[model samples]
Target: MIWWAVLGAGLGCYLLKLAGLSVPPAVLAHPVVSRVADLVPVALLAALVTVQVLAAPEGGALALDARVAALAFAVGLLWLRAPFLVVVFGSAAFAALLRLL
Candidate 1:
């Protein structure tokens, strides 16, 4: 039963993607649609990061801890145009140091 549901969901997602591809190019070329297409990935990534950093272990409440602070630090580095490697390692090291203290 679970496998069937999983297969059904996979098929549904494929069909949804196909539907998106089938949209007329004219529709996609619309100014609003084009702008939204550009912004959607950024919005989704931000939402994903926010949820991962703020969600509690039990998923029942928001959390504000070292993870959130580390995220802030990473954002600050990014604002300063830091390199990707530096941003990642700097954030990880900051989080570790926070947890230690």
Candidate 2:
């Protein structure tokens, strides 16, 4: 079952990519499509981060705690225009410290 799921997912992803490539270049080049495509990564990243922050460890109840603190710190760092590496490590360290307390 797991193998089937993995194969299906991989094939589906390839099909999606192929479909994207098969789209007419003119349509892809349209201003609205280009703007939306540009925002897709940002939207996806935000969703990913939100899920990670809100998900509970060990499949337990969802609740805010140290992870929220880390997310807050990361957001603050981003607001302050700190470098990407600093933002990531700082958030991780902050969360670890919170967890330890």
Candidate 3:
């Protein structure tokens, strides 16, 4: 049952992406739409990260903890133009250290 639901959801997402790709080039070539398309990934990542950082699993309430400290390290590293691997590892290490303390 769960597998069926997962398969269906995956299929639905793929079809939606396929539909988006099927859009006419003329419509896609519009300047405003092109700008928006460029920003879509940024917006999606921000939304995904916001949810991950703020949302609680059990109650769906917003809570701050070691994750916030880890996120701070990530942001500072990003601002400093650190490499992606460094940012990721630095944040993970900071978060683990926070948890240990």
Q: Give the number of the best model, judged by TM-score.
A: 2
Candidate 1 achieves a global lDDT of 0.98
Off by over 4 Å in 1: none
For candidate 2, lDDT tens digit of each residue in 1-101? 99999999999999999999999999998999999999999999999988888888777778799989999999999999999999999999999999999
Off by over 4 Å in 2: none
Candidate 1 — which pairs collide? none
Give lDDT: candidate 1, residue 60: 90
Backbone clash count, each prediction separately: 0, 0, 0
Report lDDT per candidate: 0.98, 0.95, 0.94
Pairs that collide in candidate 3 are none
TM per prediction: 0.91, 0.92, 0.84
Better of 1 and 2 by lDDT: 1
TM-score of decoy 1:
0.91
Best by lDDT: 1
The lDDT-based order of candidates, best leading, equals 1, 2, 3
Give the Cα-based TM-score of candidate 2 against the true structure.
0.92
